[model samples]
Target: MVRLKWRYRKRLRKKYGRLIWKVKNRKGRKGFFKSTVHRYPRRNYRILVANEYIAAHLAKSLGLPVARVIQAHVRGPRGRIKRGLISMQAKGGQVIPWKKAKKKLLKKPHKYVKQAKKLARLVAFDAWILNPDRSDRNLILHKKKSGKKYKWYGIDHGISLFGNPTKWNLRRAKKKFSCKKAYKFCLHSGDKKKQRIPRGLKRFTRDNRKQLGKMVKKIQAMPKGKLKKAIRRVPKGLLTKAEKKFIQKVLLCRHKHLKKALKRVSKHFA
Candidate 1:
């Protein structure tokens, strides 16, 4: 009876724990979930896992810049819905009020863009090259009362391990890379066309890289247990192609490039 009860509790936790949304008091709110999805043979993943992974990643890096992932949740068609995990409520750093800024104040959002790009370079150098899914939806903009603003985030990461992995390439990666970390690498790298930046698409990619780097730096500095606990909650969902080796190769390639970047930027950061 004891053994069966333990097993039952575990199952219940897994079922409810995996869900992305929650409510405190009467305020309906969202929560972040970490997840991945397998291909057809394995069956698709519910949204719960995917969203949480993103929230954790973003929340991990608000120290630098990139909006914060306040809450992420996962629920299927059958689950109740509020707004969303990474939707409007997310917060980490503060963003200047763009819509409220005036002509002279035009600098806030544009400046926000520049800092966000700086954050993205960290992602590029670190080889976290899953670009498309690293969009504004998963990230938040933070502006402080001090008037000094920077990106502080990276909320979603589930989309990267999947097929094709967001139209990424070495050249764009190089541009996003830190000039301090990979100066020479940039020199040798071929000039690849910028990922086609539509009105909103380009900005999102640009900001994600900046935040990605910020997150990595923070994670590298954190205690092992904290990081492990944070990631442990990440569910083992299936990646898009389900070809783990391919994803591994991509990550490995990115690591090698990161080494080159570190060497290039040694003078600056060192």
Candidate 2:
């Protein structure tokens, strides 16, 4: 909820013809600026913007709860315009950070069973996208007005595909695809001696194995053409022809091995 500087806001308004109200200030990362008129905030780099755009479409195809993102033009350094993305903010609920949401789930497991399942799906989604930055602050938890139910959504895929925005060569993509390591959830507490299974994952026990397997199947069943269409949605110049082809190849390859990768991590639930 950090407000943009007056000077910066004036510059953006002059170039983009929109008023920016706030920008999220994530340490070590460029902030996402929220627009007042359109509610579609601008992100930092074109590469990161393209990554968010492609990731959102792919997540939706797999039935994940991610915000809709669209390509946008924003004022860059020295009054230059650059390609960016604007993610629609979720409505009708108060957004809670993952750390607070985890505490609530752990304290009241029965009340939040549904959220646990969503977390399971999110973990699987992160693995497929090769996102290693699903930290405690990345997942957003929306508590409804009634406060009885909660909706979970994943965000910030700026470094997901190829694991590096600047480097999308086949060698990097291939190395990431061949990796067999399971994606770990950032649910562990600070005390190492008291570390145990997090409540977000505890509800997904043996009975839910079939449900998890089904999610894997759904991802595998995703048509290659659908993925192509999603990638093609990214505005031209944002992603190079070589980068697009590399991403398509990497995703298809990962889909083939998704089941095994998920199974390797899901054993903990059993």
Q: What lDDT tens digits, residue by residue, belong to model 2 across residues 119-161?
A: 5666667767766566665566677777776777776676566
Give the backbone clash total of model 1. 41
Q: Model 2 — which ten-residue stretch has the worst lDDT? A: 186-195
Candidate 1 lDDT by residue in tens digits, 82-124: 2223323333334332333334323234454445454434344
What range of 10 consecutive residues in model 1 has the weakest lDDT sum? 3-12
Backbone clashes for every candidate come to 41, 0
TM-score of 1: 0.39
What is the lDDT for 120 in model 2?
62
- The lDDT per prediction is 0.35, 0.56
